[model samples]
Target: MSYGLFKKVHYTIPVEKINAVKLTQSLQARITGRYMAEVINVGMGDDGTDQKAFLVLYSSRNSMQNYLQMLLPEFSDILAAPAEKQPRVVWAAWLIPFSGYLVAIAAGLLTVLEFRPDFLKQTVIAAAGMTLLFLLSAVCRFFTAGVSVKEDYLILVRGYMRRSVICVSYDKIQHINTKQNFIAQKTGIQKGNLHLLASALNMTQSVPYFREEELDVIKSRMLKTSHAQ
Candidate 1:
């Protein structure tokens, strides 16, 4: 694969040396059913230790996957299974996350307007307009986000204006967790969180506005992989 601007970076890993072919749904390629294809190859680290090179394919979907499988038929089983993705995003699930922001904005606007009574009326109108726009944006973002699970990796695709597709290995995930408010519980909506490599990376990844059943599927796979590792 070759990719870069002025000077392109090329990669050619032998079929035997290929570690894994990860399929993720980035916002760009997600419009069509077909998505992004990634090639994970073995590389040498700065300290002369083994590392990984995640090379993204500019062209994607079944075509790329088929070519690779033709090169190595042994792992066809893994590639053949379609990526089981939870496409549904609960719009109501975003209410709690946005509540605090709305409150803060209201409070700030009130406080600022109190000091500037001369332009209070105009300021209020402007702030209200901007707030509505932001709220609309948040709604679009929540609705467009997606999450998927695969045998070797878990992919989280979030954000609307600036999308991000994070693919973390199941083995790296230390644990899986979920939280629900009274409303969330009643509605069967929960926010899922993933704690990965407790000692190495003290960070948690989230699957926002996820349905209970879909989240359960991801939780089961994540737990099984983490424990096995």
Candidate 2:
């Protein structure tokens, strides 16, 4: 890729080093049927991760076609398997929030009965309402989230209201870490995160909530893939 107004700059990027491909469409671009894509590339150096960006053809037919051509074969599998309908660990979504809320409700119920007996009914109603909201969030998350390792990519899918799919190439991952807080430890919920070759975008691919064993599967797969590569 080469571009410049006065002094032309040329970039020779390996497909493997390309970490992210983001297409942006504005109101004008939508109507004009022309869009811009950001291609983020990363490489490892003796000092640290080196990241660079390329702005693909903007508002030009040739640029759009070039981007689509690069996008299709590169992420065909991920596109074929859409994130919105991916399978999820249903219980993992509700477990943490539900546990905390249950404890608070139990305490509130006891306090109201002992000190404010007159407000016990009202407290119960409020608790029920709050529980419903938490349940609704869990349902939404269950439908939105997924974590899968396919071929050489680690795909982390999650969001509510808007869907986000994070794609991380296995070769670029610098580290893999897992965490469990106090509540998470009690509830058997864990988080797994990948430290990829650093970039200004700080794009993270992770499984935010899951069972310990589920995270283990991802770790095992990643290690095997890395070693194989």
Candidate 3:
């Protein structure tokens, strides 16, 4: 299961100003060996105007890497940015939910001990086991989740039991939204959502507990790439 999760890598290329046909041909030529490629039309914009953007999906990470290597020189200015990982504070956000669970478990334990002395040992063991499991899961998730920005694509990496990568092209992005509650605002951590036009159903990629300033930079880069001729 872990092997399957790590096998795939998702990435994208921007073809807004470039010729899609030519770009596809170039990618195909460079991506040798066994691989599958599909071109998907992302549909019209919110204003009812035809959006010319296309999403190119590759079956494997090697194929995407080969394509990027071949295409990078031509679009260097647009794709020059390096990928960014989730900040340490992002992982700390898990403490909020963990704390809630801990509180509930403590209350339950207290109630049970007060009512029944026979169940005290069992209650204590169960609470300790649950707390350990939650902490482990939170730590694993915190280490695994991250975001990377390429020339034309924003890559979202998420995993716990199994990992998956979602690469959204700039032109295919319909909206970039950010939100922060009172606690999050105080900590300078925010949640971000990327709304995409390519999926038939409303699809969103979420980034939790990212630094607000970093998200703003990503949002700015995405906007600039989307508007590029």
> Largest lDDT belongs to which candidate?
2
lDDT of 1 by residue, 140-169 (tens): 676556665666666666666544455566
Cα displacement (angstroms), candidate 2, residue 186, comes to 13
Whole-model lDDT, model 3: 0.56
Worst 10 residues of 2 by lDDT: 43-52
**Candidate 3: lDDT of 131?**
85
lDDT tens per residue, model 3, 1-229: 0112555434354554332111222234334422222333344233454432333343354555565556434332222334355677664555677778989998999899889979999989988998888878777667656776655566665655444445556666677888876667777887778776553422466765567777766767767876784
What are the models' TM-scores? Answer: 0.60, 0.57, 0.61
Best TM-score among the predictions, by candidate number: 3
lDDT of each: 0.59, 0.62, 0.56
Stretches > 4 Å off in candidate 1: 1-54, 60-89, 148-155, 162-172, 196-204, 213-229
Model 3, position 34, has a per-residue lDDT of: 28
Off by over 4 Å in 2: 1-18, 21-68, 71-73, 82-97, 112-122, 179-191, 199-204, 208-229
lDDT of 2 by residue, 21-125 (tens): 544455456457565655555532223534335456555645565555665466535434544333344364446667888998899899999999999999999
* Backbone N/Cα/C clashes per model: 0, 0, 2
